[model samples]
Target: MKDMLWLMRNIWRSTIRSKILPVYLMLPLLGVFLSALTYSSAEDETVLRIGVANLDKTQLAEDAVQYLDGLSHIQVQMVDLSALDGEVASGRLEGGVIFEQGFSEGVHSGKPGGLQMVSVDGEQATRHIKGLLAGYVNDLDAIARIAKGDETVFAELYNQARSKSVSLSGEMVDDISADQQKSRQSIGYLITLMLFFAMSLAGNILREKENRTYFRVLTAPITSRSYYVSNMVVHLFVMAVQVIVTLLVMRFAFRIDGGLPLWQMFVLLVIFALVAISISMVIVASARSTALATAVQSLLIVPTSLMAGCLLPIETMPAWIQKTASFLPQRWLLDTLHSLQQNGISKDVYLNISILLAFTVTFSLLAVYMFERNEDTRVFV
Candidate 1:
């Protein structure tokens, strides 16, 4: 045990002293943080500049403008009718809602009304505003119909909608709103990508083996098993640096919360990263060559990561793929972290930590067995 501790300290010191580790740990973090910060600041709480051009210029058109301008998330810019397209094209406005001439006359006269929405970017928030304003017009149509003693018909139409809507939780939720679920899903993908650094670390392991330094270590008082234990310690320490860099970048550079209880977040990262470490060990032990290692990493890491909900929301994927993801460690780790964020730490947190430790132990044993039984000349391979 003392020897293991001493070996870990020596290897950790060597890793820290190396000129490459600092650079390897810094540039990627800076890049990730810069991208995240730029994106978050640009997208967050952006008050949409919406132009209102009333060609009709009547009381009803002005009322329409008033209603839209009063709503949240939009800054109504009253512009001249001629500048509507120019403002939209020049990016001064997110979109313009133009009421055609005689809009109120058409409404009072029981004729169709034409409204145009123009924008350079047809983003979601703008689309939602357009939908809301369209609904406002539809409300006018309903009110016009109601004025003709058509109460029975309106009741029947409302009943038809009520009958068609049945919720899973038995609560009649009338609105099917997009609730930024994608942001949380994207969060999941980022978490998976961060943990999946194991593959690169595995590649790091293979590089060390190729350099013949691994064999030189084995020739000292270190046995094959002890050498692997030291490597595991080294891998964990390296991943600790990775997590620190990632967190600092995520917070200061990207300006993201990255979930709550910051210490717990690091703990979750360590647990997830341990699984990646084990997976890397399995990859290194299973592969016969560097070419084989790369190929196997592509095959294993790419597809499993896809299934584990790293690239996209597994909830959106087909049922079979989601079910199959249970076999992947990435899925469990992600699910664990998500559960932690959503519901505080649950029993599943302990289960995931145990499962990851089990995987690490199992893979470490296999790697040791492979190293011991193989010819000394090729044990590193």
Candidate 2:
């Protein structure tokens, strides 16, 4: 016990003095800074300008134009049909809508047509306006069907629809998408850093073996397993510090509202830390030298982390790549965190936690097997 504690203290002291520790700890904050820049640039475009050209010359046509003008985040200007195309093409308007002649007559006959949309950017710029316009046409179609081709009844019913007895009021809900995205991205970067940091700590075993420190320590009363246990303790302690400090900075310092409580985030990250440690152990145990271990770490960690959506979102990847990412423990951790943030805790949280633990156990067993099979005393004593 004393021997293990002595080893643990020594490992901790060596790690604390390393300059790379600060770099690993600060990498997550870089994600936060990038997110801030992205959102700030995105906020510059707040309103959409649209041009409307109505040739129908009817009350319903005017009403449709008024509807487009009344929408939030959109500005509608009446334009001549000849000028609408030029305005949109010249970038004076994002898009344009044209209600052609007989448009109101078609609406009254329940066979609305001649509504056209034009935009340089195709559906991307016009889809929202098209959807809302479709809704207005559908309402008119419904009224025309009920009136049974009688223009007098259609007008009366439409006029009555304009003045309802009940008033409906709407309030915009607070949008937290920007905050959620920033937090998710920051944590994703942190996961990658944690894995790399764990690998660094686990590589200490290899360094000690190469330096003959492991055999020298074994000359004392400590067994190989006790020395490893001490190393694991130090590894977990550093991981905990990384997790706690990063999360604290994210919550209070950056004022990021990730929606989940701090404790939940801590629990999820700690479980992932176990997985990180286990995987690092496997890498260290499998490699015969520090150089080989580093080569393997670079080959495995960055690619797997990228696939697991630790750097970029998994959803942006191809479907096959996304499917493959599910096999990775990092993917499971990130998805679990995302689900908890979006929907709070539920039955599936337990399932995700179990899967993460399963990964840890599987990797740990594999690491033990590799360590036992390794004959190289210069790698793992």
Candidate 3:
């Protein structure tokens, strides 16, 4: 036990001294910060500023302008036709309505209406306003017809004027918790990857063998198992620190209400980080040269990140892609974190944790076998 502790300490010291910690941590911190900024849809909440042009300026046009002005949750300003073009071009106004000359004349005569809306978007900008104006005009036109002693069509119009609308349910289509879940879940994958790469073990694995550092370490009263075990223990220790720091920063600095018990979230991340350590060990085990290590790193990083949904939105991908991703341990690891953030740990989340543990054990066992088998001390010249 004491030997394991000493070996662990030695590995920890080597890792921190390699200058990898700062680079690894800062990269993920930057990623999380950028993601936090991008994920917020606050800009979409800005109110639309609309301009109106009423040419005739009669009571009918005034009423139409007032109706447009009275639009709920929108800002309206009355401007002349000249100002309309300039303002819309300058982006000062989204768009507005223009009541043409003789609009009331056409209305009273019961002829087809005359109104011209001037804007970049011909009908789109005015569609809602047109509907409102049309409704008001339709009812008023019916009244005018009744005032003209024609009550026959009013009942017919009212009876024939049926409207259809689709009903929607209030299924938690978007839980307030989901946004934070995705954000934190992304942070988990990024931090785990950064830590895995930043350990500097892969780059140095063959370096020590070439420099006879491994020989010197072999002279120490430690078996090869102890040496590799020490590295794994130290990696796990670093993983713990990384998890704590990230979660604390997310909670206190970002103040993101990820909507779960903070402790449970932390537990989920720590377990995933352990699996990351084992993967890093595999990276080291697979390398015969730094070049080979880099090749392996590139090969694994993109595909693994894809499976983890770190590269793109997995939900937007095909069903087959999502289904295949389920086989990846990284998928389960991040899914666990997302679950923890949405709701406290459940049986399924623990199942993900178990799968991650299985991956870690499998990878570590393979790494140990490779470590034991490696006898080649040849330097890559």
Candidate models: Cα lDDT each: 0.68, 0.85, 0.67
| lDDT-based ranking | 2, 1, 3
C-alpha RMSD in Å of predicted model 2 compared with the true structure = 3.3
Tens digit of per-residue lDDT, candidate 3, span 1-381: 787787677666767787766776556566566556666654245576778777777766686677667777568798888778898877788776677787766655565376665567777876766677788777657654654534355435433442335788765554565457546554655654654553355445556766777657767787677777777666666666666776677667766567776787667667666666677767776677667777777787677677657656677778888898888776786677677765666898878888988987898888777776664465332
Q: Name every residue pair that clashes in candidate 3.
A: none
Candidate 2 per-residue C-alpha lDDT over 180-240 given as tens digits, one digit per residue, 9 for 90 to 100: 7777878888888888899988877787778877567777887656665687778888888
In candidate 2, which residue pairs clash?
A: none
Per TM-score, the best of the predicted structures is 2
Q: After superposition, how far is residue 320 of candidate 1 from its true place, in Å?
A: 5.4
> How many backbone clashes are present in model 3?
0
Q: On lDDT, who's better, 2 or 3? A: 2
Per-residue lDDT over 61-108 for candidate 1, one digit per residue giving the tens place of the 0 to 100 score: 777888888888789998888988899898888788888997765655
Winning model by lDDT: 2
Model 1: number of backbone collisions: 0
TM-score of each: 0.72, 0.84, 0.76
